[model samples]
Target chain A: MIELFSDLFSDYTLRTVAMGAALLGITAGSLGGFALLRRQSLLGDAISHAALPGIALAFLITGSKAPLVLMTGAALAGWLGAALISSVTNRTRIKYDSALGIMLSVFFGFGLVLLTYIQRNPDANQAGLESFLFGQAAALVERDVFVILGIGALVIFLMGLFWKEFKVLSFDPDFFQTLGFPVRALDHLLTGLFVIAIVIGLQTVGVVLMSAMIIAPGAAARQWTDRLGRMIMLSGCIGAVSGVGGALISSSIPGLPTGPTIVLIVSSIVVFSLLFAPNRGIVFRKYREWKSGKQLRVEAVLVDMYTLAAQHLSAEYPHSARVLDVMSSMSGPARRTLGLLKDLGLATQLDAKMWSLTPEGVRRAELIIQRQFGGEE
Target chain B: MEYAIDIRDLTVAYREKPVLWDIDLQVPPGVLLAIVGPNGAGKTTLIKSTLGLVKPAAGSVLIHGKPYADQRVNVAYVPQRGSVDWDFPTNVLDVVTMGLYGKLGWFKQPAKKEKVAALKALAQVGMEDFADRQISQLSGGQQQRVFLARALVQDARVYFMDEPFQGVDATTERAIVDLLRDLRKRGKTVCVVHHDLQTVPEYFDEVMLLNVRRIASGPVGEQFTEENLRATYGGRVAFVSALVSGKK
Candidate 1:
């Protein structure tokens, strides 16, 4: 087992697979922050599916899997799709969501038909092309890793260079447009960058699952914090972990698709954060509300007892309390609550049966009653 | 002297359907102009066209005697509240700083001067205390105030606001209007897309009544007559007036 582990690490193919997925994951994670914030999570799905014709056209022309040709074609097609969505929405009455749905299906369908044709032709080495549909990260070559690294570096550099524009456009586009900031041009540029990230992801996560890579980590990071800078950084970290985890799990076993496995890993992180994070998580919010509600109810009961004791002006009374002296209704918990209040020193037991308010308890109860009467407002 | 903003025969369309037609208007400097109209009356589209956000099918707009594209640095815009996602995990300070992004250009971060400007803008809008709060936690009025602060940070000569008072509390509406008055006093030109007709004569010195066409434009004393109001609002006025009268 030790020898096998060493062999796996040293093997060029395995190393390539790990490196490629890691790079794609990091890039997707970085860009996903903006897409998620812009409410354009489906943009990745659109771009990834749109890259199909580009990949097929490249293969048809070159008769080989040349990374540059395929990537350039994919980027062009993706850019076209992004531009088409914008133009169609701007010029026509069709909503952006409907436009995207139309573009995604049409492009993917066309690509699939072309892919089938290529597979049936005389000259074909298209086995790897199908891997892009579900992603076989275990089969990544060194060239694939290089492609991922180069594209990832370009994306990171562009993000840093245009960080301010992206922030402005994403936050308040109207202000950017008024400033004559080339809003449409900058938008197209960013869309181009988004397509680059999605295309890079396509080779690792496949078309159907790329949305998970683009959204899951960002969504998870969002639940943990409310700062954009921190969320983006955390998203990148989460993406890196899942990328490595997916590669490890798939490589360890046969017939496990890497794309779906990676999605599962990222989704689990989201689920964990959603349930367990301290401030904004679902479980924590519900728990806090429950605990606070109990405290409020107890406070109400103590205030009721104090009001009754005030009416009597009695220094001593039996521990057992009656309800009619206080306003109207009473329940079982009210009685149990009075007993607990006496034990907590909020109330005093006198003559072995009745209940009276402590000096401190009387003041606290008076404040609560005043608040309930709208005195504070 | 050139007017603050001027449009000549400005006709704009979406696809082939005309949205704004034959609009000719001139706004002087230091004037608080309110553009009022019913829903889908091209209130937003007019602002967008002047800001160069949309291409006009015909005609032209000039700012400070030059086209908006040439004077881009001198203009600031505050969009409608609904245009942005409030749930975005950005703090008030972060959103305010976005104004400087356009002036600072690409690749450069806002400097000390820019930070001071942003904080000053936030202070002007009375949002300084909530500078670090997440945008989602803000009330509708506070959110509008934050966007105003963003426009303020631009330090531009011309400011255009789209439905700035929408969903704002009465106090917030008062505060934002006062801020606009302050801007006008400082020799800045402020144009707002206003929805409430009752506040028209009280809030704005100049008014532009629109209904996909240039119905009228001038000071409230001259152009805000019943004829223009009728043309702009159409039959909806009878129903709207009932609600308007019921308020007082």
Candidate 2:
């Protein structure tokens, strides 16, 4: 284990893999941020599945998995699928989701049939092709890593340059169209970049799980922040961590699929963020609400005591030693209420265990009730 | 006088159902015209055809005596408030800046001047304070203001707005009307698709009443009378009168 750690630090191949994974994560995550916000989160799924026929066709035509041919096939198929969905939705009455659903199933089904035929055919010498389904990172060559990094850098640069246009089209497409901007073309460009990211992820993360890499990190980051720049950056960071962490862990464990492992890691990050984020997370928000309710009840009790005692126009109540009198002034869950106030230092135990409101506690309670329910009669 | 928008027998159809038929209208420069109709009266389809968003089946849309393709930059549009996804992750400033993109053309980012114009438009709509705020954080009125700001940055000679006051509050409606009047003063032709029947005279100088067909269109004095209103919306009353007069 120690030797493997040392080797990971020193080996150039391993270093290349880490850098490649990080770049891919950043690219896919950034584009995924917009995709998730556009409520087209399932676009990643459709594109990844659509890329399969492209890969298969490219190899069948060229008889080799040449980088250029593979990318061309992937980009062509991806663009075609995206354009088809859009045109179908606009021209026909068929809904967008239904169109996307049909495209995904048909394209993926065709790709599966083609791939099976290729695997059984005697003329096809494609080795390690099945790995695209469930990625085998051990088979990723140095050239593959370089391709991922190049596509990643290009996507990031394009995103920066057309940031304003993309923002306009996604938010107010009608306004964008009104300004004579080609909103349709901009949409195609965004979807194209997303397809490229999915293609790069396919080599190692595989089609089955690459979709999660494209969506989960962005979805998780969305839970934490609303700002676009921050959300994209945070999503990139989360994707990078999941990618690199999954790669490292899978490399350590024998016979484990890297694609599923990475998806698991990405989903775990999403789960962690959804539950524990400060403002929007489920658990923390519930906790804050619960704590506030408890505090409000205590304040309500003190206010009741304060108002009751104020009738006497004195600092202390003569019959303050009676627990039943304090309890009688309040409503709803009295047993739970008295115990909470006593526990909160708002009241003190007197002789025979009777309770009296503390001065600090009395001041806090008086302010709350006065502001909330001030002499409404 | 340059006619900003000139339509010659404009006919548009959707799936063999004619939405607009043999419509002829000419909008002169520096005029603020409002198109009023009931629900599904093809008001949107008219503006869309003029903007080249929808293809006309048989007529021509000429901008400055030319096709819209030649004068695309001279025309700007503001669609209905609910037509867009508000939850998108873009700020108001970014949206407004896109108005300059038509002038800048492709592959070029908006310059500092464009940004300044966008900011100026935002100020005009009292939305300068929220220039950097995400569009989702805005109210319906604020959202309409941002879109108006975007169209203002377009700096077009002709403006087409489709139901711009649909979901806006009274204050926003007034602000938008004032903005349109200001645009008219600046010699820009503004065409608005309006729905309110009560505020037609106060808000618009000219009115075009439609009911999937041209009912009456001219100055308010000549075209917007009870006769015109009955033609546009009083089908049953017209039928009863025809029967009583022994004409039907």
Candidate 3:
């Protein structure tokens, strides 16, 4: 572990790759909060896949695989794909999900065809371009890291500047329209930012799994808080951690890939949050239900004991364990409940077989009965 | 006299089918007007068009003798409770503060003064204690009240509320009605897309009975009658007439 830490700090390639992945993670995670809240998770998937044709076309046009040119091309193509999906759903009977699916396959398939055509050339540099499909984090250099940082900073700054407008947009676009906001313009701006964030990640995470980088951090953060501001901050943190951790682990091991490793780390965070976070987590909900169930069982036994005393017209009337169990009608441990009542001074055991209510128990039972039946005779 | 709101030849369509047609209306200042119609009667469409949320096929909407765009600062809208996702990650205070976003303009954050105003609006709705509480934790009635408080913070001269009483409890309904009356007393024009016909005469000074087209729009005592209700509701006249007579 110490050797791995030293290598992470000393190895220049690992440092550049790790920094690039972390920057991509922060921007993608922050933007993903908006997408997740808007119920547009699939749109992220579609946009990333749709970016491929642009990346390929950028290479075709420039013939030089510069990061800036390729990213610009990728951004344009992703934006066009998003616009097409919106227009198709808006103008025609096609639903959003179907439009997204259609765009994803067509754009990605076109990109693959273009990629194959490019591979036919005898250029050695073209060999690594296909890595944009699954990503090759190891190929990232200092220049690429600077590009990622610049784009990521711009995205995060835009998110903060338009925080209120975007919040209103996600919560209620109709009301946002009524407020004289340029709703359509704001929407396109947000989509452009989302596309930028995705485009920047294509080199580190690739198109196929970039959506997971976009969505998982936000989803995990959502489980931990009920405030958008906190959720966004936490998502950025989770994304950063996952990015650095995945980069380190993948570099340390020979066979593991960085992108999938990042996804795996983030997915594990999501799973842990889903099971253990307070309020909305599954484990917490189950514990609450179990506690309520136990309380109900105890109340049932108390009510049964009270009913027996009422029928006999005396608080000192003793009833057998069998009679109380039969009256309670629950398949619970009746004797254990009776012992709990005795411990609470609500009931007293006269002998091994019979039990009677204490005065405090009588009063408690009467209150419960009154509440259940609204004080009726 | 310049009316608070004037809509001329307003027509709105969804997917090539008109939802509201030839809707001409002029609401006077400081009057509480209720727009009553059955389900699918374009009640919501009327409000949306007046606020420029929906693009009209052919029409114009003016507030205070000016186009809606020119008079946006003078108008505030409260959509139906069901229009927004209640489970969104926001506090009551933040949701209420959104009413001030237009006034704050672009790229400017809300400050201490804005927070104070939001808290004041919450107090008006008796929700000051729940300022920090997440919105989804609120009850349906509380949620409706919070929406009302948001509109209150806008401090606009004209307010449009769409079905403010739908799904709210009795206390919230009374609170909203009281708030409407209070707004009118302050010389503000308030128009509500109301569903309950029984309370129309009690809650509104004027009524507009609408289907796809306007049936009648005048003082409740003069224009709200069985014939116009029949024209608006089509087959629910019997049920509506019972409510009308029951009110009498």
Candidate 4:
């Protein structure tokens, strides 16, 4: 582990790749937080897949694999895809989900055709163009790192400047409209930013798995918080950590891919949060239900004892275990409840067969009966 | 007298199907008007059109003798409770502070003064204790109260509330009625899309009976009658005669 840490700092190539991946994670995670909350997670998937054709066209036009030129082309293509989806859904009877699916398949299939055409050519640079399919972090150099840093900083800064507008947009666009905010412009601006975020990740996680990078951090962060501000910040941190961690692990080990490794790390965090987070987690909710079920059983046993005492018009009226079982109608063991009641000084066991309420137990049972039935009995 | 709200020949259509047709209305200030009708009566569509949320194919709406766009700052709207996802990651105070966003404008954050104002609005709705609580943690009644607090902070001269009393507890229902009356006492025009026909005369000073077109709209005592209700609701209102007779 110590050798791995030292190598992360000492190896120049590894340091550059890790830095670039970290920047991709931060921007994608923050913007993905908004997409997740807006219930547009599938849109992220569609947008990422839509960037592929633009990347191939950029390579065809420039005949160079430069990150800046390719990324600009990718961003434009992604924006076009997004615009087409919206227009199709808004202009026709097609639903948003169907439009997204249509755009995803059409754009990605065209991108593959372009990629195949490029591969058939006699160009040497076309060899690594397919790396953008699943993202080769090791292919990123210092220049790519600088590009990621600049774009990531700009995206984060823009997010902060429009934070209030975006929050209202996600929460209630109708109310925002009533308030005279430019709802359409803001909506388009957010979609444009989402396209840029996806464009940046095309070379890190690639189009195929980039949506996972966008979604997992936000999904994990949501389980831990109920505030948008906190969720965004935490998601960014989760993304950055997983990005650098996956880069380091994949570089140290030979065969593991960096993008999938980061996605796996983030997925594990999401699963852990789903099971362990306090109020919203499944485990905590089940535990609470189990505890309440036990309390209900105890209350049922006390109420049954009170009913038995009432029937005889005596405080110390004793009933057999068999009689108490029939009266409670509980599925669990009656003896277990009796043991619990005895521990609480609510019931006394006389000799072998009879069970009766103590003075304290009678008072307790009366209080439970009154609270449950409003003292009607 | 200057009308607070004036709608002239307002007609709205959705996908070539008309929802509201050839409607004209003039509402005076300092009155609580309830727009009551059965389901699919375009009650909500009327409010949405007046606020410019739903586009009217041919019509004009004016507030204080000015177009709605020019008078946007003086208007506030409370949408249906089901319109928003309650699980959104925001606290009650943050939701309430959003009411002031119109005045705050773009790229500006709410300051300490705005927060204090939001808290005061929450207090008005008896939700001050829940200022820090997540919106999803609130009960249905508390959610309604929180939404009211949000609109209260807007401090608009005209208020449009859609189904504020729907799905709320009795206490919240009474609280919202008192709040509406309080708004009227302060000389603000308040319009509500209401569902409960039995409480129309008791809660509102004026009533508009509508089903696609306005059947009748005037002072509650003069316009809210069995005949008008029957016209608005058509054959679906056989039980309204009994209710009106009981009131008599």
Candidate 5:
């Protein structure tokens, strides 16, 4: 690990690839947060897919494989895809998802045809043009890293600038407009930023998996916090970690592509969050449900003992454990539930088959019964 | 005297279907008005068009004496609570602070002053203790109150509320009524898109009965009558008061 760390700093190509990938992660992760919250995850998919045709068209038109030139093309086409989706949904009765599907497939299909055309042409300059599909992150030069840095900074800056407006717009656009905001223009600005974020990632993560980078980081971060600012910041951190981790793992391996490796890392993060993150995690929620269910059963057993003791001559009289099984709703064995109550100091095990409510447990049972029946009045 | 809200020759349409037709209204300052009507009565559409949220096919809206754009800050709005996602990742205080976005304009963050104002507004709605609570954790009535608190921080002369009492508990309903009366007492005009016809006369001094077009609009005692209600709701309402009053 120490040797790898030193090599990461000393090796120029590995360093460039890591920086470029990290920049993509940070940009896509933060902006993807807005997309996720707005329930516009499909927009990212459509935009990235639409970027493919733009890349091929940019190469065909300019004949130069300059990163900036191609990225500009991708940005424009991606923006056009989002705009077309919005307009189609507005102008027709077709649902927004269907419009997104139409634009995404159409642009991507055209892009594939153009890519095939470029490959068939007898031009040696088109050597690495195919890498835009699955992104050759290993081939990212220092210039590409610099471009990602500059553009990523600007994207982050713009997201910070419009933080308040975009948040309100996502929450409630009608109210946003009523506040005298130009809702349409601001919405376009945010969407334009999404296009830029996608364009920046298209060269490194590639079109096929760029949308995953845009979506998964934010989704993973969402489970950890309840505030948007924290969610975005956490998402950026997750993005950076996944980017560096993917770069390291792919560099160590013989033939692993950085794009898919990074996607797998981010996917692992999402899966981990879904299963184990506090409060919102599936495992945590199930554990809480089980714990509460157990507590309820324990309390049920204690209360049944108290009720039976109330009917008898002496408060110290023990109730048979079988009586608890008859009165309680849950299917927990009476002895086990009584054992839990004893652990909680709510009941005393008088014998092998009988139990009695303790003073504290008696007080609690009366309070519960009072709340249950008296409150209804 | 200038009206607080003045609408003239207003028409709103979606495609070929007219939602509100060539309507005219003049609401004076310092009165709590209820725009009462059945579902699809264009009540929300009227408010949206007046606020420039939706385009009006024809006509003009004047806030105080000028157009809506010039006098934007003088207007406050509380959209339907159901219209927003309560599960959104924000705290009550943050949502309330969004009201100051109009005054702060573009690119400026909400400062300490904005937080103070938001907290004060929350106190006004009796939600000061829930400032840090996640919005998703809020009950329906608490969500409505938070929205009301947000509008309070807008500090506008005219407040437009869409269904403030819908789905709220009885205590919240009374509290909203009290807030409306307080706004009236402060010389602020409040217009609510109200659905509960039974509470119209008791809660509002001015009432507008609408169905596609204005059926009747004036003081509740004079305009909110059985005849106007039957005309507005089209005789299928089955209201007991209408039957009792009609017999009288």
Candidate 6:
């Protein structure tokens, strides 16, 4: 652990790779919140897959492997794939998802073919190009870090500038239209930013695991908060932590690759949030259910006591506590609740076997009945 | 004076059959109107087409003598509650602030003025106390009021509400009715796609009974008769059954 922290700061290669990975995480994670909210979580998957062809084709056409050139090529190809998906869905009876599947497979398959072609006609330059498939985070120098940083900043700025429009369009495009905003333009802008986010991550995270960077952080963050602003911020934080942690861990361990390691860390965060987040987490929800059930048990005992008192025409008429065991639907000893009720002064034990509601308890039980029958429900 | 809403020869279709067939309608200024019909009668389609949310195959929609696009500022719409995901991670005030997004347009953020307007609108719908509450925590009626509050923030001259009272509690129904009357009093035009025909005479001043075609439209006393209702709802028996069921 000490070595990892020490190396994270001093080792230049590790530092550069960490910065690049963190940039990819923040960009993809924040924008991925919108994509998730827009019900287009899988869009990242399709676009990232389609970017493989763009990366290969850029090298083929330009014969240059500059970060900017390759990234621009990848962004254009990713944008074209997204555009084609829309056109096919709009023009034909084909569904949006099916069109995505078609574009993803076709572009990726073509990219493989191009990659093989380049591989056969190999020069030393072509050797490192194949690393784009899985990504060589260790090979990411300071220059690559700058490129990712520049693109990530641009994407974040665009998101902030058009924050309201992007938010409204994601939530309700029809309502956004009624508000006199250009729905299509905002949509294209968001999708364009989405493509940029995918492209910037291609070198460090690679196309295969880039979609995970986009989706996992946002999804995990969603479990943490009920506000979009908070969700986006939290997602960015998770992504940063995952990126830095993944880079350090992958560096310290000899065989573990950085891209997949980052993916694993992000995925673990998602699993953790899914189980442990306070509001939406599975564990919290189960805890809430269990807590509510306990409350219901106490309420049932109180109400059952009230029913008996009412039947006897006296609030103080002590009845057999064993009768509550028969009256209550919840599977627990009715006597177990007396301690709680006694603490609240809502019930009193007249004897070892008998109990009755205090005046307050009777009032509370009546209110509960009224709520069940007549109130806001 | 120009009619608040003027739709002419509007037609919308899914596939073979048109949902709305050459429909022509108009609403005068300062009236509470209810668009009533049986299920599958293009009630929602009418509102969508008018708001330019849905494309009409053949027709034109006008707001205050201008095309809808030109007059969107003076128009507010509340779509069906079921149309959006309630579990969406937003507080009540944020959703209400969306109503003012029209004024902000693009690139500008909603500030103190917008927040105050949203809060006032929430008060109008009796949801002021719930302004900070998450949308997912709301009851069905509270959700309906939030949607109403959103529309109210628009503060438009013409309002289009598509079944705002669906699945709401009696309090919300009363609140919505009082709100519609208040809108009418202020000379703001309000049209609601309503399901409960029993409340037609008590709630709406003007009624538009529609099927695939325009059956009748006018004051409730004249156009809301059994004869027109029968034609709009496919004969007397179905209409009676629909009324007995209380919701269509």
Top-scoring candidate (DockQ): 4
- Give the Å error, residue B72, model 4: 1.1
What TM-score is obtained by chain A of candidate 2? Answer: 0.87
Note the B-chain TM-score for every model. Answer: 0.94, 0.92, 0.97, 0.98, 0.97, 0.95
User: Cα lDDT for residue B244, model 3?
Assistant: 71
lDDT of 4 by residue, B8-126 (tens): 99999988988999999999998999999888889999999998888899999999999999998899999999999999999999999999999999899999999999999999998
Worst 10 residues of 4 chain B by lDDT: B239-248
What RMSD does each model have against the real structure? 3.8, 5.8, 2.2, 1.9, 2.2, 3.5
Q: State the lDDT of candidate 3 residue by residue for A1-377, as single tens digits.
A: 78867876899888887788889889999899899999887899999999898999999888879899999988998888999999999989999889999999999999999999999988887877888887778878999999999989999999999998999999999888878899999999998899998999998788898898889998999999999999998988888888878877876676566778888999999999999999989999999998888778777887888777777879668999888877776547688888988988989999999999889888888888788899565
TM-score of each: 0.88, 0.83, 0.95, 0.96, 0.95, 0.91
Model 5's CAPRI class is high
Off by over 4 Å in 6: A302-324, A329-377, B15-17, B235-248
Q: How far is candidate 1 from the true structure (C-alpha RMSD, Å)?
A: 3.8
Question: What TM-scores does chain A show, candidate by candidate in order?
Answer: 0.88, 0.87, 0.92, 0.93, 0.94, 0.87
**Residue-wise C-alpha lDDT for candidate 5, range A251-317, written one tens digit per residue:** 6775576778889999999999999999999999999999998877776766677678888976557
- CAPRI-style quality class for the chain A–B interface of candidate 3: high
After TM-score superposition, the amount by which residue A265's alpha carbon in candidate 1 deviates from its true location, in angstroms, is: 0.6
Off by over 4 Å in 4: A313-316, A330-335, A343-345, A348-354, A373-377
Clashing pairs in 2: none
Q: In candidate 1 chain A, what residue range of length 10 has the lowest lDDT sum? A: A324-333
How much DockQ does model 3 earn?
0.82
Please give the TM-score for the first chain of candidate 6. Answer: 0.87
DockQ of all candidate complexes: 0.66, 0.38, 0.82, 0.90, 0.84, 0.78
